[model samples]
Target: MLRELPVALYCGAFAGMTSPLVAGSYSFIILAGLMSGIILAISKTSFHGFGGKLGTIAFGGVCCVSLIIYILN
Candidate 1:
């Protein structure tokens, strides 16, 4: 949906910046965006109002990546 575009883009940009490689970053961003969109649509409720879903997704993604790095090192 048009409403979700900005959220997706923002998430994608955040992922790309934090990720190690460009290609992999884009993939991660797209996957995160898709997952977030699906969850938001299915939930039918917003936790923090508009764009909250996307923020949650982005935060989750960052946390996951951080955990991965911590475990790997």
Candidate 2:
């Protein structure tokens, strides 16, 4: 929850700042952040004891954004 807030904010801000250079697919970054947050939230509740879950969620989120951008462009 609170522990991941900084990471989310940093990732979201970075995504937004660099979005214009990403072939005009800015929304993907925001969506990625939102999706990452959602996935993390779900993972937290579903896999409380799991290890390295945040990293996995973050990677998945970034991968999703990349895929969307690649497909769109």
Candidate 3:
């Protein structure tokens, strides 16, 4: 179970680095995280062997949350 700790820590670091102004709130952060996780899962093979894949995934996650917030507000 603990074998995935490093990946979890890396994901958490990406989330933690998000600015408060952009993240807006803790809930938003959580939502962005979920979005990123979904993106990562769906894109497991699509981006294989590419550099900055995690960063791209993180950016995609933030963008998704931003779009959601934009549409709702």
Index of the highest-TM-score prediction: 3
lDDT of each: 0.56, 0.64, 0.78
List ranges where model 3 is wrong by over 4 Å: 1-5
Give lDDT tens digits, candidate 3, residues 1-73. Answer: 4785565556655765788889878888888888887877788669668788777787888889999899999
- TM-score to true structure, per model: 0.42, 0.54, 0.82
Give the residue spans of candidate 2 off by over 4 A.
1-31
Predicted structure 3, TM vs. truth: 0.82
lDDT by residue (1-73, candidate 2, tens digit) is 6887886675455445443555256566668777777776666557677775666676677667778768997
- Return the lDDT, model 1, position 69: 51
Residue pairs in collision within model 2: none
Query: What is residue 67's positional error in candidate 2, in angstroms?
Result: 0.6
Candidate 3, residue 70: the lDDT equals 100
Clashing pairs in 1: none
Q: Write the per-residue lDDT of candidate 1 for residues 10-71, one digit (tens) a residue.
A: 65455455455422455555655555455546554546555555566666665565555569
TM accuracy, model 2:
0.54
